[model samples]
Target: MSAQRPKILIIGGGFGGLFCARRLAKADVDVTLLDRSAGHLFQPLLYQCATGKLAIGQISRPLREEFAPYPNVKTLLGEAIVLDPDAHTVTVRRPDETEFVIDYDVLVLAAGMRQSYLGHEAFARWAPGMKTLDDALEIRQRIFTAFEIAETLPPGPERASWLTLAVAGGGPTGVELAGQIREVATKTLANEFHSIQPEEARVLLFDGGDRVLKSFAPDLTSRATQALTELGVEMHLGVHVTDVRRDGITVTPKQGGPDQQFAARTVLWTAGVEAVPFARHVAEVLGAPTDRSGRIQVEPDLTVAGHPEIFVIGDLAGREGLPGVAENAMQGGLHAATCIRRDLEGRPRRPYRYRDLGSAAYISHGHALLQLGRVRVSGYLGWLAWGLIHIAFLTGVSNRVSTVATWLASIARPGRFHRAFMLGAADRPEQRYTYSTSDLPAEGHAPGS
Candidate 1:
């Protein structure tokens, strides 16, 4: 290592971390990016993967491949268990459970948030969140398998249970998942089943808020809700889930009503997320204040209040009004890199100013919702914008090409043709397990943070 070169350690490979490493490639510093996952995921399209509109390879690229052109950048797969900003050292645990210490002159904490089951961490098994490749794969399997199971079962409570799909949280993820799931069941798998009419599947999007896509404008939210309803998704607004059972979920209407039990064999959680357990260590070690969500409170320069050399970006940073979206993470990462570069030259570090590129949710084939500041768009034009933006933002050209090809095929097919409800794994449904309510911290992230 050169004495003049600073050792920069970035603790994630999400949008923010990857871009940060790229921005620092030619800065004459060694950049080591550590993530538990092997690839950098294009998270905005994760809902597509969950709905079978895309394959894993279409939305993720190997982290090593992303930095191969830059000799100064290195990628490693490991869980960051501990962060010591004062000591300028991070303790990483490898896949084998072996721990190693790495010292850095500057540290960037882009470690993203993990899927939160609200207060019920145990609900994860019944309904997986659409965050990581594994999460999406599990959902796709569970969903398709549900149809197959429903086909085999007699027309009874069990069959009805198998046909029910519940999506918790009407945010972008839930909206996208609900809409696509409706499309798959109603349009894509229209003729794939025998005894079961896939269109009969009861798809529900339940949210505690008054409307879906609460982050978007009211008009846009209303349009998204209408789109979901037209596609046969039941939008149950102002409802809070109290318990998640293997057979279904129990919820109480937030507006005062008797508790209700919705029979859903599969439920997907898109409700909430907290920072990784690692963030708690940062806050505890630094006496930094974090909200109930456990994100770190950082200075405007994206560093801990008193720890100037330590930067927290993405979902981990508790920036006052910043949304927990990909754009904020990307901006935070780039700004942190800029600050590091400026600091290297004995200059002042610049504050991070997040720019919202807007929030969007994909609604079925030719529908979507886009919100950028005061502007709101929906319907076919919105879908085009959504498709173009996601394709353009994919990690690499290959990913983009593959996604384009995938989209083209969907256009050419009946829809979600990825599965034929074959007599394979779908023949044997996964047994339901008892979900626990213990609030355990999240282990690692699936890209977004």
Candidate 2:
């Protein structure tokens, strides 16, 4: 560690922190990036991984490999538990149950958001949200296992219940997931089962709102709705889910009509998200103010109100003035980096101004909704644009190639790899103790032991 150079610490390795660290790579400062995971995940493609459309490696890159050439930048794999602004130090807990205290001249908080259970924690037992790679893999296992279970059941209501898939939200993630599940059931798993035809599988997308894709234009939403419906997806709009259990879901329409219960084996929750717990620590430590959602409110420069040295970005920061998208997070990270450089050079800091780059979401095969200024495109052309843009935005060349190859394979064979299943025993901690080296013979030690 060089004492002469100023120390800049960034928390979280998502869009914001990674962008900020990359921008300050050549700057005259010591930059350290810390994240809970060893690899940086491109979250936009998580649904694809969950749906078995892409592998985990195709959407994630190792953090060390990503910043290997930048000697001034160091990476730490840990979870930030506390922030002490007065001492300018952050307390991070490592995976091995050890704590490390790192002091910084300037700190940037970019910890992202997590799934919001919305006071319904019990629903998590049946339906898990898509937030992390583990969550995606678990969901993939659940989905694939449901099909396997359906194969064993007799042809009746039980089979129907096993084949029914429910998505709780109508947002981009939910829509994409519902659409992808429909495609997987119809095209990929069409001929796998003997008793039940995969095409008969029901995919239901439920939303309390009247329309799907509420963020987009009405016409585009209509087109997406139609596209999904054409793909054999059932849309339950304007309905509030009163209860979600393992067997099915009970929903009541907004008009106070009769309660409806739909039998579904797998329910995916993509409704809402709240900032991680660390955001509250940042706020309390720096005395920074936050919005109602517990997201830090930053100034135009991405700095906390009373603390110029402390900056907050990404989903953890509430930019009421700007939209909370991945692009905005990247821009905010760049802005934070620029401000840090300016402060080091004894120059005035510039205000953070966000530029709208538009938004796009894929509904189904060769179909998407794109909004670019006044120009709104839907259908196959929009889907092509979405694919190209995502490929261009991916982090590494290998990831891009892998994603493209998978997409091409899907176009060619549809469901070439959907049959892959988790065959081993489930993860259990007690098994570890049973396989300890102490229980093994000295000359015949097990491979792992």
All models, RMSD in angstroms: 5.2, 7.0
Candidate 2 lDDT tens digits, 1-449? 23579899999898899899999999999999999996789988888888887788888998899999999999999999988877889899999989999999889888888887677766776688999997888678777777878899999998899899999999899999999988889877888789878899899999999998888889899999989989999999999777776678988999888999999988889987887888887887777777766888888788889788888887777767676678888888999999988877879999888888888998877788899889999887898888887887788788889888877776656564643545333355433322134333347532212
- Tell me each candidate's TM-score: 0.92, 0.92
**Candidate 1 lDDT:** 0.83
lDDT of each: 0.83, 0.84
**lDDT per residue as tens, model 1, 147-166:** 87799988989999889999
Query: Which candidate tops lDDT?
Result: 2
Off by over 4 Å in 2: 1-3, 409-413, 416-419, 423-449
Clashing pairs in 1: 112-449
Output the worst ten-in-a-row residue range by lDDT, candidate 1. 431-440
**C-alpha lDDT of candidate 2 relative to the true structure:** 0.84
Worst 10 residues of 2 by lDDT: 431-440
